[model samples]
Target: MSLLQNVSSPADLKGLSAPQVEALAQEIRDFLVESVSKTGGHLGPNLGVVELTLAMHRVFDSPHDTLVFDTGHQAYVHKLLTGRHDFSALKKQGGLSGYPSRAESEHDVVENSHASTSLSWAEGIAAARRLSGERDRHTVAVIGDGALTGGMAWEALNNIAVDKDLPLTIVVNDNERSYAPTIGGISHHLASLRATRRYEKVLDWGRETLTRTPVVGAAMYETLHGVKKGLKDIVAPQEGMFEDLGIKYLGPINGHDTPALEEALTLARDFGGPVIVHAITEKGRGYAPAASDIDGDQWHGIGKFNPETGLPFEVSGRIWTDEFNEEMVRLGAERPDLVAITAAMLIPVGLDGFAAAYPDRVFDVGIAEQHAVTMASGLAFAGMHPVVAVYATFLNRAFDQLLMDCALHKQGVTFVLDRAGITGSDGPSHNGMWDMTISSIVPGLQLAAPRDGEQVKQQLREAVDVDDAPTVVRFPKGDVGESITAQRQDGSLDVLLDVQGNPEVLIVGVGAMCSLALTAADKLVAQGHSTMVVDPRWVLPISDDLLRLASQAQHVVVIEDNLVTGGIGASLRSALQEDDQWQPVHTFGVPKRFLEHASRGQVLEEVGLTADVVSTTMLDRLGPTASGRSD
Candidate 1:
């Protein structure tokens, strides 16, 4: 039997010998490559943490001794060891979730997918344990160097530093990159520590002595620790940042070495206070293709790839991101003052090309979303039109900054939100559904939900033209299909398909939902009802033309890829209600619930956002009349 096959639980790992553990690490790596190639998830981060996780499980008991993963992509080994070996249907509906899930395993402490949050969680749990008098229980947080770039990690560090009494072991898994190379000051300091060799040797010798000769032969620890510190000042005078913070600083140990990792973890576990064990790890460790991945973002997260060639099995068509990238490059050439910024996602949001084209103009602000938005506002204030391109889900981190720093100040900053709606496999936290809902409350921020490639460019151009308030241009994850030219225009709203006379139903399609609405429109017309479809590209600041069209129709239906609660449908319904003609406005959209991982099409069908379901719902409401509503 394979070494991995035996590891059904953390308790199972306790019986393994030294050489056996090494064999298991190699076995786990082989398992990861084969399994993840068929059903893609995070490959690079997981590869780096194989030995680290094995050592962690060996050193501390899980469930009883709490362990946390900051960016939970590295928890694949944890999943494998904890009996979740079924990798056949990973990231698909009813299969294993890509990130840590509370529903999946008791081993997973928190469902953290986003970076720089694990440290704070560890602190809180540690604090709670102490208050409840569970002093024996230890809380350990494994954070990536990339996550350290985020402001929250620093906040947690500051809070943890002062406590000193908190029994939390923060493991810094420094791979030198979050998605790409981690930027800013903290990363450089860590790099300097990595360069400074012999920290491991010196720290190991000192820690061993303390453990060996307990002053007063145990129970009295302060005497021996004080002696070790006094001797350390004479021997190792190079005081590091962690030492300055009043927290015990350990070595930049080799993360891949199972024995070394276990030794370090054991010492930290018994440290009895807040201690940071910095270990240098290689991201995409065992896999050659992933280890040397250009910019590191491609290997960070993947979809079914060829094992031999390391090429993705799935082929994709032109999407909204491609159009956005091309436009940014063109804009860069024409307008020198136009700058683009991203929150450490240079490639994912299609800002790589923009950064390459306008080398000086584009800025990657690490993983700090709030800093990126506020920095863009600063750039705009300095008379430059700054475009902030980021994933739709991540913008939730920067809403306060987007509102106060940009919109309140009337900064000419354009937000290009990629993966705008129903971002399938990445799950609920990733979909850009909340952008429109959040924008509804933020004053002076204009919102755009482009239907296709043509509208993407056109809306982006129009957004940049506005110099006063902040403008948002949002588009979805997949292919940007054929653009449907409008028959006419209603204010800024484009009427994609308009019937001859006063329509029985007015179907307003928001952004990518135009295609879905158009299909639904065809079904509605077949049922012998006058139906018109309008693409409300600009979803917010409720259009004058949409209200007029809603007034004409008896039953008005609004379809969007966002939540129905505070979406375009609700706003349009409110406008129609105020205009005296109260049309029965039916809405089709994603429900305000945490969605699981599935294909975009499957998710749409499940949420009743499909063409057939929407048309049937509208037709059922008609009920043989097909007449204008007189309600």
Candidate 2:
């Protein structure tokens, strides 16, 4: 049997010897490489944490111990060791999730896919354990040093250190990158210390010897310690950052070494207060292709690729991101006042090309989404048109800023929200379905959803040109639909299909859902049921003409890719209800629940937003009417 087969849980890991553990680490890496290559899940982060995860499981009793993983993409190895060995269906429907799932395993105590939130969770769990009068149980949080850039992690650290004696082990996994090379003050500080090798060695030796010295005793020790303070001032300058915060700081240990990780974790377990073990690990360590690349973002979350060739299985088509990037470049060229900003998502949001072309205009505000939004607002206040491009999920972190800072002020900022709907594979935390629902509530905020490539460029230009209030143009993560090139030059709405005159059923499609609506319309047309498909480019400032068309139809079916509650459909429903002539309407979209990890197609099919399901549902609704029975 393989070394991995012998391990079912952390308890099973306790029986293995040191050499056996070392062998298991290699086995796990091999399994990870093979599995992730086929499944196209998180490859680089998981590869770096194989030994660290093994050491963690060996040292701590999970579930009981309350071990939390910040940005749980690195938990794949943890998932493997905890009896989830089926990587064939990783991130698929009803399979192992890309991140930790509460339903998947008891070992996964927290379900966090976003970074910098684990420490806060650890603090609460640790405090709860203490409140219940339990002392033996440990609460450990494994957070990346990159995640430390986020303000929430520091807030947790500050709160946990208030007591100065709280038992919490914070493992700082310093891979030097969170998607991209980590930026900001904390990362710079860590980099400075990592560069000064001799200073670190001296400090380690001094701490070890000064506390254990016996010959000098009381008087001599105190005298020497006083002089040693001056010596430390000359040697290690910023060593007191964590110490002053009332948290013990341990070595920048080698994270790849199982023995070193085991030793550091053992010492951390014995330490009677809040402590951080700073471990330096190489992201994508075992994989040669990933290791050789300086930028880890390409390998961060990848699709199915060949292990030998390192080439992905499929080539991405011209996505909405491409059109956004191209248009932003043209806008910058055309208008000197146009500026673009991103919250550490330059590549994913297609701002990399924009950044490269106009470095001065593009700002990467490092994991700080709140700052990105407010900074853009500030730019807007300065008479500059600032376009803040961010992921739909990450925008949730800046809702307060969006509402108070941007909306209340009515700042002329344009938000280009990529992944604006049900982003399938990354699971609940990463889905962008909430953007429409949340942003719809913000007063004076104009929202647009383009159905195809041509509309994307046109809408983006219009959003940038709107100087009155905040405008948001959101699009999905995949390829753009067929280009709609023939729009009336007078800004009149283009009708893709018009059954408005004598329509039995009118389907209002939003953004990516237009294709599905068109398919449903085709099915209805075959069954001799008159149907109209309208793609309302602008979602907000509810289209009056479209509503009028809906009033003319027998029934209106609103199909969107966002949440049902408080989404575009809800707004439309409200508009129709206020109107006296509009008939009954039914809304179809993602349900009000956390969707699991699956392909985009799978999630759409399950939610009844696909062409087949939409067509079927519409046909069912018009069954008696189509059969000429007016009962």
Candidate 3:
């Protein structure tokens, strides 16, 4: 039987010898390459953590002893060990989640894939364990060096340091990249520790000269440790950041070596106080293609691809990301003071081109979204336009900074939120559905959701023009669909289609939902309903002209891709009602719930955002329709 086949649980792994364990690691790597290549998910981070995960399972008991993975992307190996071998429907509807899910098993804790929250979670759990007198149980937090850049991790570390007796093991999986390489000073210190050549030389010299003899030489070396300590002090004193923080620092250990990892983990678990096991892992470890990738992320996440060639089987159309990236270069050329800021994801968020064109203007602020926004506010205050680009989901971290620092101060910071509105495949926390709702609550913030590539370019230009307060440009993932032109441009609102008849249904489309609006309009026309489709370029604070048009119709249907509550549709409905245009207004959008990990189309269909579904719902509500051409 295959090594993996016999392993249903971590206990199954206990029976295996070192050679068999090594064989299992290879099998797991092969399994991941084959499975992830077919289904498409996080590959690089998983590949790096095989042995570290094995060591963790061997030394510390899961469930009985909590194991929290910061940013959960590295938990694939843990999943495999805990009996979830099937990867057929990975990241699909009714399938295994891409990140850790509590719904999957008791072994999986914290479904979050967001960077730098595990440490805080671990601290709380350990504190609870102490209060309950469950001191025998352990709490281990495995976080990447990249996650250390976030302020929350530092905050947790500070508190954990103070306790001194809290039995928490902080495993810093230093691969030196979050999405792209981590920027700033903390990364530099980790880099120095990773290159522990000076410390190694002192130890190696002692091993060769003094320790070669019998017990007498060893005893002499221990008692007369001046030479060793003197050399180490002058060369490289091993007092690193962890030591400075009053936490025991144990490694620069070989993260791939299972035996060494087990030893390091065992030491940390037994060390009473909070300890940091500095495991030096190579990102995209065994996979040659992943290891050699030069661009940002280095196959951190991928679609189905050829395992050997590491090339995608299908070519994707120009996505929303491409349009924004192209426009950024053009904008940079036009405005020299226009700068771009990224929170350690320059490539993934599509700011690589802008960074390449104007290197000085681009600031890669590690995995610190809060820092990125505040820094952007500072840049904006100094007579410069700063465009802060990040994933829509991650923008939640900078909410306070964006609201208080930028909006309150009336700073001209343009936030470009990539992957907006129910971005599927990465699970609940990854979906960008909440950006619109969050923006609506921020006063003086103008939110723009562009429909197509052309509109994206136009909206970006418009967002950059706002000299006071903050402006936001958000768009969903995947291809920027076919352009739909306005039949009649009315200021900020564009009338995409209009039919002359007795006032009936007015469909208001927001951003990419314009195509769906057109489909519904056409279908409503086939029935005997006079339908008009209007696309409001600026979704928030619905235009006065659109409100006037809403009064012309008997009823209004606001179609959007954001949440049903606190979104553009909700605001529009209130405005129409307050104006005493009290028609039965229907709002179609994503319901207030976390979306599942599935294809974008699949999730949209599930939420009733498709054209057929929307049309049928509209027709049913309008009652019996007589056959007549309204358009």
Candidate 4:
């Protein structure tokens, strides 16, 4: 039997010898590649943390000590150690989640998938524990070097530094990568300390030589310790950044070495105060394909693939991201003032091509979304039109920045939100359902949801042209299917299906839901209800054209992939009410709740966003009139 098979909980790890633990690490790595290759989850980040996790389990009593993981993508090993070994249906409906789940295990805490939040969580937990007089229970936050790029981690660090009594151990898993290679000043600082051989030897020499001189030896070591920060920098450029903050710093220890990680962790745990244990490790250490992937394309967040060949089972078609990618490069060539910014995801949001084309113009602001948004405002102030590309869910982090800094000042910044709505498998935290609600409240911010690849390109150009207010262009996660042509155009509206006379129902589809709206319109028309379908490409600000069209119909049906409350439909309803035009308005969308992990289609169906569900509900609401009875 394998070592992994024998292990169930963190307690099971304690019984194993050092060599046995090393064998278990290999077993875990092999299991990860095999299982994740079939199931498709985070494979690279988890592979690197096997030994570090094992050491953590051995040193700290979890569920009591309170171990927290930043971003939680790397917590798959932690899950396996804590008794969740089933990987057959990972990220599918009713299956294990991609990140740390509170419902799945007690060992898991701070299940938020966003980067650089673990430190703040650890600080709060540690401070509360100290106030409650629970000194025995330790709090360890395992944060990546990539996550440290976020401003929140440093904000938490600044607070954690002053409080010397908190029993908190911060494990800086300096694997030199997050979504991409760790960027900015903090990353460069960590990179300088990666070469620790000389520093390690110098410490060994000091320990052996200084302590041998009896009473004076101890005093001599103490005398040298006063300027140790400078002395250490002379030897290896360790300027004692953490020590300057008043937190105890330890190790440039090998993260893969089980015994070394255990030793460093034990010291940090028993330190009786906040400590930073900086361990050097590699991402995708055991797997050749993953480790060699410098661009972080296939391995970081993967799809189903062959285990041996490391090739994907299916090559996805040109997606919504590809539309943006080509347009960005073209925009770069046409406009000299055009610049782009991303919050650490240089590649995921399709900015890599733009960044390469206009290297100086593209700014990768790390995982600091708030900083990226405000920084775009700064760029706009300098006469450069900045396009901020980021995942829709992450845009939530910068709402204040987008509102106060950008919109308040009338900065002409364009935010291109990728994976805009109902991103399944990654779970509720990842869904981009709240963008429309939040962006709608921003006074001058114009929001657009593109229906197809052509609209994605066309709308993006239109958004960049607006030089007085913040604009948002959102698109979904998958392939932008065939373009749906309109029968005719009415102002900014694309009338897909215009019934000859005054229609009983006006179906307004927002973004990708336009196709689904057309499907429902067919169903309604088949039942003898006069249905007119239109795509208000830009849904925010409640267009006068849309209000007029809604007034013409007996019932207005608005469909979107965003939350029902305070969405485009809600805004339209309020506008019509203010104009004193009362018509029965029906809205169908994702309900205000945390949707569980499932396929996008499954979630849409469950939430009654599908054509059959929506059409049936609309028919019931309309009742058996002359229009419906004609069928």
Candidate 5:
């Protein structure tokens, strides 16, 4: 049996000899390369952290020693070591999660997949351990250098450093990229440290030489430490950023070297105070294809691919993201006032095409969602029609900015929320179910949900034209369902009125929900029930035409991919009630809770958003008497 096969947990790993452990690291790497090739996960990050994770397991007693992973994509190796090695059904419906799950393992402390914030979690754990009188246990936070660019990481560092006595070890995994190339002050500081070779050499020599001295050795060591600190301040002004905050800064060590990592970790364990270990590892190590790729973001999260060739599995043609990119390019050409913005996700949201086409018009703010939102608002306020293209989940980070800066100020800011639904495989942190519920609370904001590629184009145009208040156009992650030609473009209202007669049931479908609604309508028609499937392009600001249709219909079913509570359904229900019409309304959407990792289709199916489920629900509601009337 292989070394990997023998190991079920860290305890099992601890039983192996040093040479055996070294061999096991290679075995684990091979397993990862093979497993992720089939499963399609954060392969690059996981491949980079094998030795670091092995060293961590060796150094610390986990479940007792709190180990927090920032942006849990890199925790795949940690997960495997903690006995979640069954990668057969990884990220699928009934399989292992993409991120750390507390339910899955005792070792997995935090389930944060977002960049930065692990330091905060580590500090919290350290504080709790102290309170509980478990001082022997260590709190280790493993964060990528890319994640350190985020403001929250610095805030946590500042707080952690305040209490020098706190037992914490922050492992800075410097892979030189987070989705894209890392930006900001922290990246530069790390780069400077990496360039400086004398810092490590001097420290090592000083420590060795000072200890050997017979008398006044301790005093000489203290004096040498002060001199080293003074020199570091000159070489790297920001070198003492963490140390100044009261935390001791360790080496910019080679993270891939098992012995080196183990040694550094041992030192950290021995040190009874806050310390930051800066370890450098190449992202996508061992895999030449991924390592050589200049654009690391593209290879960061991949689909099922051939391990040998690094070729992805075939998927459906052009998605909504592609369509958005095409439209944005066209719009930018037509309107010089139009500007595109994203929070470090230029490639994912299909903005790479737009950025390439009009580099001057596109702005990529690095991992600062709140800043991106407000910056877009500023652009809009300055007469530029700013379109902030962001993932639906990430937009939640800037809710207050969207409300106060854009909505309250009545800035003509257009928000194109991509992946605005149950985005599976990426796990819970990535799902866009909260966009509708959260945006529904933003006053003076107009919200839209497009059915397909054509609707997305039309709605985007309309949103850009609305120069009065903030407007949001949301669409799902995958391909646009059944390409439809543009029919009519009524000013700010893209209507597809295909109602046969005075329909009793009006299926008001939001963005991606239109396809399911149409299928449901077909089933209702077969059951002899007269139904009207209307694509109400705008979800918010309840259009007069939409309200009129809703008032006339006996029952209205509001279909959206977002949460049922506090969604567009609630707005529709309120609009119908205020009209003095007692029309019964049913909301079909995801429940207001964190769902498990699964495919978008599987998640939708589970939540009864599929065509079959919708059809059955409509049939059950509109029984034999209602089924008598033919369209």
Candidate 6:
């Protein structure tokens, strides 16, 4: 009676009748809502793809067929079908991963969460199969319409089009959104395709009418279906984009209809070439709360919430995003020359308020980070200071563009990197740990890591004022917390903690790590060791004050929320070494390794970033009797 529990693998779906499959779909949706509500995972995207993913598994032999999901967040349904049913500890350490993990199952092929990459992965996999002479094996890439806006997707499409013999099937899951509603030309094309419902209706009519008449009538209808392309040209003229590219095109199929999805996918599996099976599905189909969300982002990636009311249990306080959101609105009013840009996330990066107030000034370039960065450079060339807001991890996509277009040409573009540092639950790919390291390599790029809400506002203003080069203001994921005021200003450095005696320990905290640095300094002070803590507002171009302080101290400690290697701490140590000021500098930061999924606090504690740990480590480095005076 329980269709979901009985169905453990794709093999189990083979024996089930059409009615059973339909029941299983509803079961899957109910399971998703209940499980994800408790665990706080990607509920909406998974719900939308239930029927689509079910149809794929039922049609193709996965693990052998090789199905890759673009932006693997939607692979939750895929995970369930492949025997990973426990959703109790999703996105937690020692539990199931939010994205597809190779260690979890053989069914998952690609695990990268970055969007617009499935087409390229499919291309490579399909090409390898061809060279290996594995004709029976097929490759399927389920890419969202939002991902199609990316330049890499187009590049892969161009490559795949030329290879008619490549055994690849591209399913464009046209959900009409990626966080926000998808923008640009690809979305428009998909919208046009969705509008051709008349053509589908006519075919359905012909099939029903012809089958009833007789054998001759069925034959006539089959002939009509074969030449439906010419008929489509007359009826739906906007339908040849994929066909023109030498890839076989099939249906603007209803993605939620399991039977209809099966028919389209089966045809694609047998086609033996690169085919684009366009599926039109809702972002949030079954769940009433997600489906009714007007702005379309609340359920995209949600926190733990009540399934009945669809509200979070705890009300969030003013976060890092809130500060950025308020400041952007104020900045829009003050500076007309300030324009805003986001890859596709207008709402997520705190530009929604700015867009609402000054609609003409903000641009959502879809899921194309490279284009957004270079376009910002062009806007800068035209005398407007463009603010490109994006997640710190995503900034990795446009490194060459930032280095060559913005920095090389001397463009004044402000990059607001939200969710910087250890973003624990989303896993390794989502963490913003590499921005400081990567941005440090770029010449004339001034980077800032804001300590609190007030500093996020202050540093953002300073970032936009630079007209000769690019600037970056990065902050972490959660709450901004209590603001830490400075005891004294030391030439652009904010000294939060200073001891009366001659300081032996000099602690330099970068951005959000300043609070932790001050806490660690207090621990040393309580132990009768004089310690001084300072935050260099602008982390780059290692300040004269920092070098002067480092020279006077017996031990220099630099802590940051970025990669220890090549981060600001490393840069400061290198600067000190270059100046021949060897005060035995110690750098503290995220280790240069892929971290597992956990809470931010849990990850920090594991990495020994706690106040107690840091102070004890510093004390051990200094002898037990060591104090303000070294000897």
lDDT of 5 by residue, 1-631 (tens): 9888777788887667778878887888788878988988898888888889998998788887888999899888898888888999899988998889998999898886887789899999999888889888999999998778766887888788778668888899998887877766777878888876543563465446547765332234334445344223322322556656767776777888776676566556655667777889888888887787677775798888888898887566789898898998999889999998877778888788888988999887777788888998899888899999989998888899998988888999999999998898777889999998988888888888888888789889989999979999999987776864334543444444355557878887888877777788788877777787777778787778788878878889888899999888888898878988778898899987788899988888888888888778877877775436532
lDDT of 2 at 309: 84
lDDT of 2 by residue, 1-631 (tens): 9989988888989888889988888898888888888989888998889888988888888878888999899999999889999889999887899988889899887786877899999999988998898888899999997788777888888898786557788998998888888877888878865665433453454456557766331232234446334232322232457867767666677788776676557656655567787878898888887776577788888888888888888778788899998988888889899998877668878888878888999887777888888999899999999999988888899999999999999899999989988889889898899989999999999999988877788899999988868999999998886865422321334556675366888888888888778777888787878887777788886778767777778888889989999988788878888886557687889999988889998888788788778777777777855467421
**Please, what is the TM-score per model?**
0.94, 0.91, 0.93, 0.94, 0.92, 0.94
What is candidate 5's TM-score against the reference? 0.92
lDDT of 6 by residue, 240-263 (tens): 677567677777889988777776
Specify the highest-lDDT model's number.
4
Residue 174 accuracy (lDDT) in model 4: 92
- Cα error of candidate 6 at position 101, Å: 0.7
**lDDT (C-alpha, whole model) for all candidates:** 0.85, 0.81, 0.85, 0.88, 0.80, 0.87
Sort by lDDT, best first: 4, 6, 1, 3, 2, 5
Q: CA shift at 147, candidate 6, in angstroms?
A: 0.8
Candidate 5 lDDT trough over 10 residues, lowest sum: 229-238
Instruction: Give me the displacement of residue 327 in model 5, in angstroms.
Output: 1.8
The TM-score of predicted model 4 comes to 0.94
Check candidate 6 and list the clashing pairs: none
Per-residue C-alpha lDDT of model 3 across residues 1-631, encoded as one tens digit per residue: 8999888888887767889889999999999999999998889999999999998988888879999999998888999999999999999999999888999988888998898999999999999999999998999999998899989999998888899789898899988887777768999998888777443443354456445556432233434345334222322333477778877676687889887677556546755668788888877889998876655375898889999889987678889999999999999999998999998889988899999999999998888999999999999999999999999999899999989999999999999999988788888898888888889889999888898999889999999999898999988888887899899886768889967753589999888899999998888878778888988889876778878888888889988888899888788878888898788788899999888889888999999998899888888888875663322
Q: In model 5, which runs have C-alpha deviations exceeding 4 angstroms?
A: 15-18, 202-240, 485-497, 626-631
What global local distance difference test value does model 4 have?
0.88
In Å, residue 271's CA in model 5 sits off its true spot by 2.2
Each prediction's total of clashing residue pairs, residues at least 3 apart in sequence or on different chains, is 1, 0, 0, 0, 2, 0
List where candidate 4 sits over 4 angstroms from the true fold.
198-239, 627-631
Tens digit of lDDT per residue, candidate 1, span 61-159? 888889999978899999998889998888888898888888989998878588889999999999999999999899999999888888999888888
Clashes of 4: 0
By TM-score, the better pick of 4 and 5 is 4
Clashes of 3: 0
